[model samples]
Target: MGRGTGPSMGLMNDLGSKACEAWLSEHGEGLPWGQVVAHPCPNGWELRHVADAGRDAAGLQALPPGALREWADTADDGLFRPLKSAPTLRRGWRCLVSSHDDLELALGGVYPGGLGDWWAVRTGQGGPTSFREFMGRQTGVYRGVRGLADEAARAVVRACCHAGSCIKDRRWAVEGMVDGEPGGHGSIPCLEPCALVLEAARTMARMASAERTSVALSGEDLAVLRAALERASALRPPPGTREAELSAPDNPRRMKLLLEWLGPEWARPAASPQE
Candidate 1:
């Protein structure tokens, strides 16, 4: 699908460019944003994936501003990246921009409205949508998400919005909780829930509504399950696994939620706060 090109989008683009330029001037060179690192080169600026920040530019794929969208469309394994802010951005690419407009275009191609979101948060003009607000606005397939138990809802958010999955700092919170910490300068801010998170919430809501069948397992069995899930979560997803397919039992976020539900013994702190 094509991106919005209306007047509002143009204004956002301009604002994003202005904010980015100001940030660069204040922070100077070599500051990293999300998975990207930017540097002031002799001509203009050089941007590359954080993984390739230390590599020689001549060795990486040189892409123009216009090609960044295509370059960011897939992962190194050729999987379609459903979330642009996902930590799975492919490395080995470098982009050069001679002007702020070019930099805006290039960054937009890489992170979509990332700079604009950052600007909104920095300027206090926009903020995150709370879990309650996000659910209240849902319709059709996602409308039932409002019925999910509050704790269950928080678990879903924690699982899906975990830094392991996406890099955007979540400012939204479940009801009764305040906004998340505004991170240090240059961090990308998530102002609202994304479609993927909504999908996960929907999946969780459906699971919550399902009939409960008790299957007793010993502590050892539960331990084994936690170990297996922890191992899986740390490894690369299977080639056939779809990262955004929450209904699939093997999806990473689902595993994370399951881990959260299981209350893994290893996850507990050895030293209590009272200590």
Candidate 2:
């Protein structure tokens, strides 16, 4: 049977136990998304859970850069971003400044953006400072950066990272396999990709801080985008090759990608037994 595109709400018990479904919906936040404990209802909704998603160790793969936004879609829907109240970036966040283990950055500073949201950094005590203020003080690039309340900003950041961008060593860094690495299924992270992702995220945040929508692409949508990036990468200009001939051949959107203005994300690995 077919299922609803997203969370199935306001339905009755004939399809499944009202109380149980309600329990999962209410209590399943923040828990790693668990499996469907019960059989799916005729309505085609599976009773998914959230707990120890990391249990799938071999299943773990570094989240792709551009893909971060998609992952957050799972959070806002109340599936993974289990918040005390509604999921909002304005809740509370703490930044552990190494020395300040108990630094509570703000009353609200974290967003369980979703599957790929960086839970590690959000784990402990933060300070009363705004996330942007904290970030701005630390670096020149973030000097003018502000506002993490925008869902779209978060998405743009995630997608850029999935494409292979991240801030590492306290600076925007890109991780990827230029061509490919040993275990590198595709692009590895590096500095350029990180810069690209940050630029995109900032632009998106500035343009639409108020926009809100669940944007994790459907499996099919991700697959298509991935393929498109890969195909474009093939025509990228080789190093030191200054001639236009060194540039990507005439192709749609190929130039931007080949230029590494966008990075490629690593693919997810198969599930292994949890440690």
Candidate 3:
């Protein structure tokens, strides 16, 4: 089916419910989903950040399931989280939910359509949207992204979708891009380009079109820049750093893409899983 008209909301919700049921049946209710851990209790299900899963429930702040949306909307430092699946989910809170539907609702707030996308792929009713397919549908400012060179497109995909930035497995690919390893426990599949990706592409396209300036730098200068970007990539930015602010030269993804353009010698090692 054409991705634009893949499935109705009702059908997707039903499939997502089935996906939740099957997942629980297979992995048990205690298994973690992304950064959240869901445990079936006599009362219903108790949800907490994986970091707090082993902590005493009394030690963590208790929050209503409805509050999860706001909680997940921002990181622990109050920065907007553009990607819900990003590893930066805040900890130190627990939620109580009463029914399977409520549990799904709670999780939906945290991951947004994650369960539906999982089931859609598993059932073969949906699949990844290629970069070409995704950009072809773009309009307005994003229309310029369609003109991005293949090399720039791949770099954007790698920088924006790297596991270091988001945990969702990137099922989508563009020309010259290689497949990424499947994500581990608690990870979900990303079936298409997100808004952030589209915006990043637009930015890169504009950057590629801008007037070029040349500056001479010593070998040591290049080395220092690479080292700095490496350190930046290896650590989370300080609280309040805007992750979605792509125009910032210091944005981690933009730094990574810059490293990509500098060739393999300047490339930083892959970010550690704990980063």
Model 1, 1-275: lDDT tens per residue? 01122222343456655675665664336767778888777667788888898898789999999899998888888878889988888888898876666767888898898877877877888888877888888898788987777777777776667666788877777764435522222377887888888887888887777888886877567667677888887655578888788777877777777776554364443454574
Candidate 3 lDDT, 32-86, residue by residue in tens = 6778887766665678998897898889989888788888998777778988988
Measured by TM-score, how close is model 2 to the native structure? 0.21
Q: Go through the candidates in order and give each one's C-alpha lDDT.
A: 0.74, 0.30, 0.74
List residue ranges in candidate 1 displaced over 4 A.
1-17, 26-28, 176-186, 264-275
C-alpha displacement of 175 in model 1, angstroms? 2.4
User: In what order do the candidates fall by TM-score, top score first?
Assistant: 1, 3, 2
TM-score of 1: 0.85
- What does each candidate score in C-alpha RMSD? 5.9, 21.2, 7.3
How much lDDT does candidate 1 score?
A: 0.74
Worst 10 residues of 1 by lDDT: 1-10
State in Å the error of residue 171, model 3: 1.1
For residue 118, what is the lDDT in candidate 1?
79
Instruction: Report lDDT (Cα) of residue 78, candidate 1.
Output: 84
